[model samples]
Target: MAAENARQVEARVPPQDTEAEEAVLGAMLINPNAIPVVTDVLSRDDFWRESHAIVFDAVRGLYADNNEVDVVTVSAELERQGKLERVGGRDFVHALAEAVPAATAAGHYAEIVREHSALRALIQVGNEIAEMGYKRPDDVAQLLDRAEQRLFAVAQQRRVSDFLPIRQIVHESFDRIQSSQEGKAHEGVQTGFKDIDDLILGLFPSNLIVLAARPSMGKTSLALNIAHNVGVDQKVPTAIFSLEMSGLELGDRFLSGAARVSTHKFRNPRLLRQDEMDKLVRASAQLTEAPIFVDDSAGLTMFELRSKARRLHDKHGLGLLIIDYLQLMVGDTRAENRQQEVAGISRSLKQLARELKVPVLAVSQLNRGPEKQTGGGPRKPQLSDLRECLAGDTLVTVSSTGERVPIRDLAGETDIPVWTLHPDLRIGSRLMTNVWRTGTRPVMRLRLASGRTITATANHPFLTVAGWARVEALRERDHIAVARRTPSPAEPLDFADDEVVLPARVAEKVPDERFRHLAESDVLWDRIVAIEHAGETDVYDARVPGTHSFLADDVVSHNSGAIEQDADLVLFIHRDPTDETKKGVVDIVVAKHRNGPVGTRPLAFVEEYTQFRTMARSDDREPF
Candidate 1:
C-alpha cells in the first residue's frame, strides 16, 4: 500500500500541455515565418519539460538575431550554447519538427501552451503563498501584500498581446490624427495652457511626464491648474496623490484658483469680502461636482500607490493621475541607495501609466545646481538634473507633423533666442544673473514707432542710462548677467589684515561675491541701509543709490521691473525675499510662448495666498 501511494503521488503532475508545446516548437523549426506569430505569446518558461524549454530558448535566440529558425539552425544554436546534449541533441530537434501537422496552426498551439503555462505558474504561486502562510510571518499585512503582488505578477505574465501588422497600425494612427486635426477627438488631456498645448499637443495616455522645478516655482500650481481643467472643465476623472500636502489643502487650492479668491482669504474666511464669499460658495459647488479625487496619505510606497491606483482606476475609470512630487515617495528598503530606489520608483510609475492607459504627471524637485554654480547665471533645469530618476538610455519620443522625433532633437529644432541684463547690477542684495548662459551672444535691437530699427552689441553697461536709451523694448526679457570680478593672480595676500585669511570652510554657509566685496570694503555693517516692513518703509541716510533695499512686504525689490517700462512686453521673475515659508516665487517667469512670437500674458500672483491667476483686465497693474 505504501509503494502504491508513492507511485500515485509521483504520477500526479502540475498542469501542462506537452502536445501543444511540442507542436509549437515543431512549427517554429519547420517554418521561420511561424516564429514571429507566437514569439510574443510564448516564452521558454512556458514549456514544462526542461529539454523542450532549452530547445525553445535556442529557437528564440536564433529568431531574435534574424537567423533562420529551422531544425538545422536551432540544433547548431543549441550546440553553440552547450545545451544540445541537455535537450537530447539534433535528434530531438528533428523530432519536434516531425511532430507538427502544419505551421499554420502555430498561433493556436502557442496559445494552448501559454494557457497551460499560466496554470503551472498559478500552482507555483499558490504553493509559495501556502508556504509563506504556514510560516505565520510576524507582519500579516506585509505577507498579504507579498502574496497579492505575486498573484498580480502571475496574472500579468498570462496577458498575451498580439502583434499587429504595420498597415493596420498605420491606419489606426491615421484615424486618430485625423480626428484630432478635425477637432472631433481629443488625443490627450489638455494642460489648460494654450501655448503649452501647441508645443506638446496635450498630455497623451501612457506617457510619464516629469514636471520639475525648484521649490515655489509654481509646479504645484500648474499641476493643480491642469487637474482642475481636466476634471471640472472637461468632466474627466482625475486623481491626485499628494504625499506632502493634505487633501483639504489641495481642495482649498482648487477653490482658490476656481473662485479667483486669494489663498489668504480661503485660510481666513473671516477676512473674505461679500463678493469673495459668493465666489467661494459657487466655486465650492462646482468643485463638489467635478470628477477630481485626492489621496493625501503620507509616505506611500510604490506598491501601495499602485494598489490604490488600480482600485481607483477600476472603480472610477481614472483618466489622469498626478503625483504631487516624486521625492517624498517611500522607496524600497532593500535598495542599495537613494538613486537606485528612486530609479525603481520611477520605473514603477511608468509601468502604472501604461497599465492604466492614462497620463501620469509626476512632479519632481530640481537639485541645487543653480545655487552651487560658480558662474554668473540662473540655473535652468535640465534632463540630467533629474537626479538619477531615469535610465541613461531612456528615449523620449515627441510626435509633431505626423513624424515622431526624439525630444532632444525637438529641443534643438525649436531653439529660441534668450536675453538677460548685465549681471553685475545688484538686485535684492544679489547680482542679477542670466538663467540661460550657454550659446548666448548679446545683441541689442531697438525698434522705434517710426518703423526704424537699431542694432548694437550688448557690451555697453546695461545698468547705465546710456544703455537704457538704446533699448526701446524689454518685453519677454528677465534676469541680468553680471561680469564676475576676476581676482588678480599677481596681487599679494594681505596676511596682516585679520579679516583677510586663507579660504576657510564653514558649515551650512554658502559663499557669495557680494558678501566678499562687502567684507573687503569693511562695509559689512552698511548692508542693511533700508528696511521696508509691511505698511511702513524706512530708508537710512547711507543707503546706496541703486542697490536693492530690504523689503518685508513679501516682495523682492529688483531692477527687472524698471527695465520692463522700455519694452513692449518683458518677462518678469519675482522672488519673495522675506517669505521663507514658501522659499520660492509664485510666477517665477512670464515670457514668450515656445512656438509663438514674443508677448506677455499677465498672471496675478498673490504672495500672501501663494496662488496664481490670470490677471483681470480691470485689476490694477503692479510692478514686477
Candidate 2:
C-alpha cells in the first residue's frame, strides 16, 4: 500500500526547470509515501482533540452531500463562486508544494525553527519594517521581494525542523496569509475565546490596559466585554486567566453578557424568567461549541501565563489572552524586588503581545486617590493615577454610574478620555463620555467623552494648545507665585498686593465675602477684573481657629445675646490651591469665644470645617 501510495505521489510531482534549479535546491530531501491505518469512525466517544478537531471540522464544512475530502474542488468552487482568488496561479502553487517534502516525526521542525537564523532575521526585518510604518510603494515592493526570497529558500530547503516553536510559525503564518493581502480579513469565531485572531490580524495589540477605579465600577464587566468580543464576536479563540474570581464566576459573567442581563442582577436563578432560562440553555449549547477557552487558573505567575498561552495557541490555534487584573499575579522569576516582579510581569505581557501578536489585556487597580465622586462625567485618568501599574502599553480606568455612560480612560500624558460604548447603548437622553481633568473637580470646564480605543483620537484627547498652555501657565503661577505680587510690572496697576489677575470667568464669579481674600488694597488693578474673597474650594478654604463649624464674620446692626452666628475673632486657615494632598480638606479655624464671661476671661475654643468647597455654603448650615 505504501509503495502504491508512493507511486501515486510520484505521479503527482511536476518537472523542475533549470532556472529554478540555481536559485536554491529544496533541502535535498526524499518524499515518503502514505500508509493505510485503521481508525475508528465509530469510536468509543465522539470527541475530537487537538488539531484533528479543527481540521476535520473544516473538512466537514467542505463536504457536499458526498462524504469525501474534496479540498481542491472546494477551493476551486470558492474561486468560481468569487469567494476566493487564486494567488500566483495554480502552476506556481503546484511548484511550491512540490518543493515541500512531507514532514515526519523525525523531521525535526523544532530544530529548524531554532537553527533558522535566516528565518529569525527575516522576522526581525519584517517587524522592524512594520515598526517603520507605511513606506513608499517601491519600498514596499522591495520589502516584499526580500520577504518572498526568504520563503523561496525555505521552499527549496524542504526541511521541517522540530526546533521551531509552534507559536512563532503560527504567528508568521497569520501575517503572511492574512496581512499580506490588501483588505481586512475577519476571523470567524469571536471565541470570547482567544487573542490569536486579533494578533494574527496584525493590528496594534496593547500589553497593559489598567482598568483601575474604585471597586464595582464595572472593571470586570469591561474585561469580559473585550474578552467576549475577541472570542465570540471575532472568533479569535481566547484565554481568560483570572486570579481573584473562580472559573464559574467568570463564566457567569459571560453568561450574563450573552443574556444581555446585568451581572449583578443575574445572581439568582430562581428570579430568572422562562425566556431567560431558555436563553441560558441556548447560550450554554453555543458556549460548548465556542472556541473561547477559560482557565480560571489561580495564582499564575507571568511565566505560567505565557507558557499556558503558548500551549493554547500551539495546540488549538488560540487567538486572544486576558488576565483579569495585574496586581493579583506575581512574577515567577526569583527576584527579591517587588518592583522588579511587577516590571517583569509588565515586560512579559508586552512580550506576549509582540510574541503572540495579539492584545494581551491585564486589568489593574487604580490607587486610592481615584475614589472621586464625579458629577457623572468622564474624568481624564492620568498616568500618575496609573503609577501603580504604569509599566505597560496604556493606563486605562473604567467608571460607570450604573445607568450612566461607561468611561474607559487611557490616561495618556495629557488628560484624554476615550469612550468605549455605542451611544445608542447608553442609558441617558444625552450620551457622551464625561471626562474631566484629573485634579479638577468635575467642574470649571474641560470635559469631553471623545476618542475610541486606547489609541488617542485626532482632536479630542486634549485641550487645544492655547488652552493647555494657558492652563499650564496658570497652574505654574499657582505653584511658583511667591506671595501674591503687589502690582508688579507684568501685572495691571490697582492690583491688590496679593490679588492674582484671574481669568475673566473667575472675575465674573461672585465671591462669598465670608471667605478670606488673599489681598492688599487694590489701587492699580486695571487688567484685573475683580478681586474680592477667593471662593472656598476643595483646594482652598478659610478656616476659623476652633470649631467644626466655619466662622463667617458678618457684623449685624443688632446684637443677639444668643451668642450665635457672629464671628468671634475668626482666624482663616486655608490650604494652598496647589497642595495636592491637603486640598481635599482645606479648612478654616475660627477661634471660638464663649459669651458666658461676664467677669471671667473669654473661653477660647476650636472649630473645624471638614472640606473647603463645603465652606461656600457654610452660611447654609443651620446656625446652631
The prediction achieving the highest TM-score against the true structure is: 1
**Model 2 residue 34 CA deviation in Å:** 23
**How well is each residue in 470-505 modelled by candidate 2, as lDDT tens digits?**
111222112111111211222221324234343332
lDDT of every predicted structure (CA atoms)? 0.55, 0.36
Model 1 — TM-score against the truth? 0.47
TM-score of each model, in listed order? 0.47, 0.36
Candidate 1: global Cα-lDDT? Answer: 0.55
Q: Tell me the deviation in Å of residue 599 in model 2.
A: 69
**Per-residue lDDT for 78 in model 2?**
40
What are the candidates' C-alpha RMSDs? 17.6, 25.8
Clashing residue pairs in all predictions, respectively, total: 13, 71
- TM-score, structure 2 vs. true: 0.36
